[model samples]
Target: MWSGPPQPDEGLPTGLSAVSVPWKNLGPSKGHRESPGSLVENPASRKEAQGEEHSAAAPLDVSRLRSSSMEIREKGSEFLKEELYKAQKELKLKDEECERLCKVRAQLEQELEELTASLFQEAHKMVREANMKQAASEKQLKEAWGKIDMLQAEVTALKTLVITSTPASPNRELHPQLLSPTKAGPRKGHSRHKSTSSSLCPVVCPTAGHIPTPDKDGKELSALVRAAVEDNTLTIEPVASQTLPTVKVPTVECNNINTCALSGLARTCHHRIRLGDSESHYYISPSSRARITAVCNFFTYIRYIQQGLVRQDAEPMFWEIMRLRKGMSLAKLGFFPQEA
Candidate 1:
């Protein structure tokens, strides 16, 4: 009665399906025993078939899920790269700012070093100048002390001479150097404004009594007077004349000087002076003061004058101007006219 191929059953036997079942017995009428739809389909057999289909679809679902996870991983990696790039850029900018700050600090340090070095150099210069000034001041003080010591010695010598010397004449002429000395001959380059002006002018020294300008004879006379004013010796000695009347001078004592030849020689220091002829006649022994002082007497001066030492004619005038003559008394020595 059925014409089409028979319907498939909901379940099929193992190793046999509904399609294998002959729907029509076209080969032979005896081979057809049942139709495809007429086959028995149990509930257990249908469950087994459905379970197999579900198992077959499981692998496809897993494959699809794995592909979706791969896509998600790729997208996340791109976002991570962008975040890293932004962080690195911020770091680079911070590094540049740090480098700028370091450069500024180094420049400031260099400038500070230079300023400190300059300050130290200036302080060193000031210290050096201060030391130089201190040294110069010390040198000046030493020279002044030396001068003071020399003046002290001169006072002792003046006291010695004042004890025995005779009074000077009231009619004594003026000192040659007191009233403006002779003008020196002009030098070849006189207009050059040289420092020799001190040499030309008279150097009136109040302390050393009378220090005249440098003349032909003033140099030697100054040296002699300086020795007397120095209180060191009696350079110009009077002659001892036996033919003329003898004036006895008592043996002298110098408490100021007690060393060397002047030590025990006070007894032998007595001498009979020839009045009015008080020229240098004999040489006396020098004391322990100056070595050349003994030989630098009037005799030596006369010899030097003969050998072209010019006129020191102001010697007597210099002696007169000095106040040493005030204490001198010729009447004390029993000379020509005795004083009242």
Candidate 2:
């Protein structure tokens, strides 16, 4: 073929006439017909093209997203487990502390109870001792009161006896038969002259002053004595209680014994008579005789007082005692022995 510029369709020669061709016929030949617009050719370009096609056509990867979510969940579970372990450990420590405190409280309570019981026991013992002492003191007080009451009653009885026995008869006289034993006998030089006789007599009268008056004749005194014997005013008894031990007492038969006879014939003479004798030595009932002797002894005391044997201040008491004893003898029939 000649290589030249082609003619237009309207001006082409007959040998070289323009042909009518199909649109497919415009493409290159098999080797060269691969136009860039028609078919893919470069390998990099094909891969790019394939990737774009996959992107457009493929579905989402749901399995990969699910695996990633599982990994995150496992990490959160481990964190929560660590926090739970810390909380459990704290709770255990708190429970142990609470138990220890409870034990300590129990021990304290037990000690307190023991102390309280001991104190109560001590208090009970003290109260019992005090009660016992109070009872003992009360008993002693009652006994002392009883003794005082008895002493008062005894004193009252004695006073009543003294008051009841005071008033006496106005007329009473000594009996001849009751005269002193000395009068029945003769004096020392006259023992050869007389014979003596004795008899018992009874007289009852109140105790009072019935002293014999100064009179030459014994007739009035004798009549009064007879009246006194009849009156029965004097009553003699053994002392109610014996103050002195071992002594004889005058008998009822001796009641009429004439106390005035002890003064001898001269009424002023104080010498008492002994049995059947004018002399002083021969006596029955020696103790009674001694008391009578003591009255005679009073004259000596009076003499000694004048000689100042006793102090001047004490002399009055001696005279008063002597006078009282003399009076008492007239009343009581027996003498109270005067102290030396």
Candidate 3:
């Protein structure tokens, strides 16, 4: 009902209005500049006046303000620097991980390429044939070899003969039975067997009891006498056991190495890689042939336990064996990768 004019906003002291005015007037409206001496009576009075004026207005918090502002600035700068350093470190770690992954990917790709190539298989074959006929090709090969060895031995023996011995005519045969088999019966438990292989047989002279004092031409005595085997086949046998030189041999026992099973193991692993064995094809690639030698030489770092003959040849293969040990699922060939 008393809405004559709109009142100012409330929530103030009852007697005070929202819009206020300073009622106390110091002088007339005409402005004038005062002398410095009149404005400040003395240093103490001026300071007291300034202090009272400051107190009358509002309290200003100056203590520790500049120091706190400086501290805050320093803390903010330090935090920014720490954040920047952390970001840089994280970026570096990410880069390193990416590089490692790239290298691994390259290696994997190479292995995949190799695995996709052609497959290979290791082959083995064995055959046995005892009887040999003069009409067969194998017989011709044996005959030629036997003749060569016999001729060489005869030449060597002839070199030792004195010039005083009787000479034979060119038409006469120096050894009549050189091409014929011995007619004497074989001794018990000592039989001969002719091999169908093209390998050469060693030459053996007759026993001391059958040696003649002088040479004979086309004589009735047999030059060589050997027993027959159970199969009625003839084979030349040396008086003593000896190792013959062989070509393209899979392995050789030498330098105090009694067995070369290590070589067999390496070959088997190579074959497995050539085949489609996934683990072998990927990990045991062809290039590993040369790499394994270097790696195996460093195997002195570990102590090894062995079961059979220990050989220098096995040093490299033993390390490979330890890595590719036999599992329950599968095993390598009996002659090769199993434990060569």
Best by TM-score: 1
Error of 2 at 233 (Å): 22
Q: Model 3: residues >4 Å from true position, as ranges? A: 1-63, 119-340
* Clashing residue pairs, backbone N/CA/C < 3 A, model 3: none
User: lDDT tens digits, residues 220-247, model 2?
Assistant: 5334323422332211212111111111
lDDT of 2 at 191: 31
* Candidate 2, lDDT over the whole model: 0.40
TM-score of 2: 0.34
Candidate RMSDs in order = 22.7, 24.3, 33.6
Cα lDDT tens digits for candidate 3, 1-340: 1113223435434443332223233342357656676546555654454445445433232334566789999999999999999999999999999999999999999988776652221111112222333347676886676677666544533332213223222111222211111222333332333341122222112221232222222121111111111111211111111221211211221111111112311121221111111111111222232233223222211212231122246677666556544321122222223322
Ranking by lDDT: 1, 2, 3
Error at 127, model 1, angstroms: 0.9
Expressed as tens digits, the lDDT of each residue in 1-340 for candidate 1 is 4345444445543333332223333342586776555445433554565456545655766676788889999889988999999999999999999999999999999999999999999999999999999999997887676566545534533433333344221110222221121222334322312443343334322222443332325345446445543433443332222221111112321221111122222222112111122232112123322232322233233333443333356775455334233322322232332112
After superposing candidate 2, which stretches have Cα over 4 Å from the reference? Answer: 1-64, 151-340
- Count of residue pairs whose backbone atoms collide, per candidate: 6, 5, 0
Alpha carbon lDDT at 8, candidate 1:
48
As a TM-score, model 1 comes out at 0.39
> What would the TM-scores of all predictions be?
0.39, 0.34, 0.20
